[model samples]
Target: MRSPTARTAPPTRTPLATGWGTRVLVVLAAGGVAVLVLPLVALLAATPWRDLPALVADPAVLQALRLSLLTAGSATLVALVLGVPLAWLLARDDLRGAWLLRALVTVPLVLPPVVGGVALLLLLGRRGLLGSSLDAWFGLTVPFTSVAVVLAQVFVALPFLVLSVEGALRGADRRRALVAQTLGASPAYVLRRVTLPAVAPGVAAGAALCFTRALGEFGATVTFAGSFPGTTRTMPLAVYLAMDSAPEQAVAMSVLLLGLSVAVLVVMRGRWVGGLPGARPPRSGQDAR
Candidate 1:
């Protein structure tokens, strides 16, 4: 009898779709990233390094920075107050015309900033519809004022916050909220304790984005608020003005703004990666005891 030898099966090789199309996609993606990076590289290379300190410390830059911070902060606060509830309603409630409502609220995101400024002007200018009444009743002028900057920022930034919060609400576990409700927790209490905590990460991310957008607001703020130094001129408006007379200073301003934008992204990266507050880790059966 011939000795039987065990025959081993050869390992099966899986074929991957690494074709020409894939190569083309990879090349295109790299090219696209390079295009985006080149501008910043050029900007940094051309920046006035020696005069940066004096340029940034100039009164104009300081004023613009102060105004930008004030307006952006105010806008963020306004967005939180109005947007959080709106987002909650949009995400959880079965309201009629919700889609239409969302579309209307988000119109500013797509609309040109200049157009939005004009729209705000028509709605709140001295002789505007409600504006005329306000002036008549209380002499409260809105446009061409500091308040106008905040309003413009809020108009442009609200959608970012609302969308963020709504996404968080949608992704949250509603079972805990329901359980709270069943345990006789008031709606308000549950919202304050359970709902807000669950969506806190989105809220934080949204606030940062909103503040960033408000800080960079240019067109609407210029149109509706008018760029008056120490009154309504923001950092971006300062940049525009400085570009004509002080190109180097403008570059400095740009660098600061760029740094701020980068910082916001760096800070919010963790939230985007799902490291949310109040989110509990899964427990093993033995650990649960």
Candidate 2:
């Protein structure tokens, strides 16, 4: 054929470097996932399946479990009632020393739970400053009571709810809420109708976290609540008690607590992971781009 047709060059790849980079990232991610997953797997594998029913049915275990749920639930409710308003104030108000107040609010987060318990005892114990007045006037004692258990858990967990809700409130568009208010909606109406919907996921996440933290509250409960069975004792208390005479029992209780913790985390992940699509990710790397 007369004139040779021009030869076409093969399409070139984007680059081998890009492919290698992706491979390295995937491998690193896989390793990180493995590191986190293996411990949970080991705990499940080591669980005493045969003894689970017996351990669960044990009266002491049952009592502790019941108390744990009751106190943790109560604490979460308390946090919701008090912490939500506090979060609103932190986010929306222009109060003086607001930053200082926020720092104070999170003090419990850094303070040791045992230290928190001791502080509570100092402020609310039988011989405590207010405790003395409470005893003299009302003949009331908080230490070693079921109420004390709830109080301890709330003290340690309230900050989690407050901080979560406050962050959510801050991130949400205030303009939308203001628009609702300008459209003849009352402040309360705008908050209930416009603001709360935007922050529901954060509230859910905070509650889940508070519940989990309260469930595992051992140091404070032991120090202030005294681990009284059917009264102040909770799942963590049961585990500690079982550690001495029945090591198997201790391990069994540990497995139970572990399971409960994992369940809470799973529920939190499912409920809050992608619930607020408009909300920003906690870290820059989490951004989808």
Best by TM-score: 1
The parts of candidate 1 lying over 4 Å away from their true place are 1-17, 273-289
**Error in Å for residue 195 of model 2:** 1.0
Candidate 2, run of 10 with poorest lDDT: 280-289
- After superposition, the stretches of candidate 2 with alpha carbons farther than 4 Å from their true spots are 1-39, 274-289
- TM for every model, in the order presented, reads 0.88, 0.82
- Minimum summed lDDT over a 10-residue window in model 1 is located at 273-282
Model 2, residue 51: distance off in Å is 2.1
Residues 84-180, model 1: lDDT tens digits? 9998888867788889988998899999999999999999988998899999999999998999999999999999889888888888989999999
Clashes of 2: 0
How close to the true structure is residue 146 of candidate 2, measured as C-alpha lDDT? Answer: 96
lDDT per model, in order? 0.88, 0.85
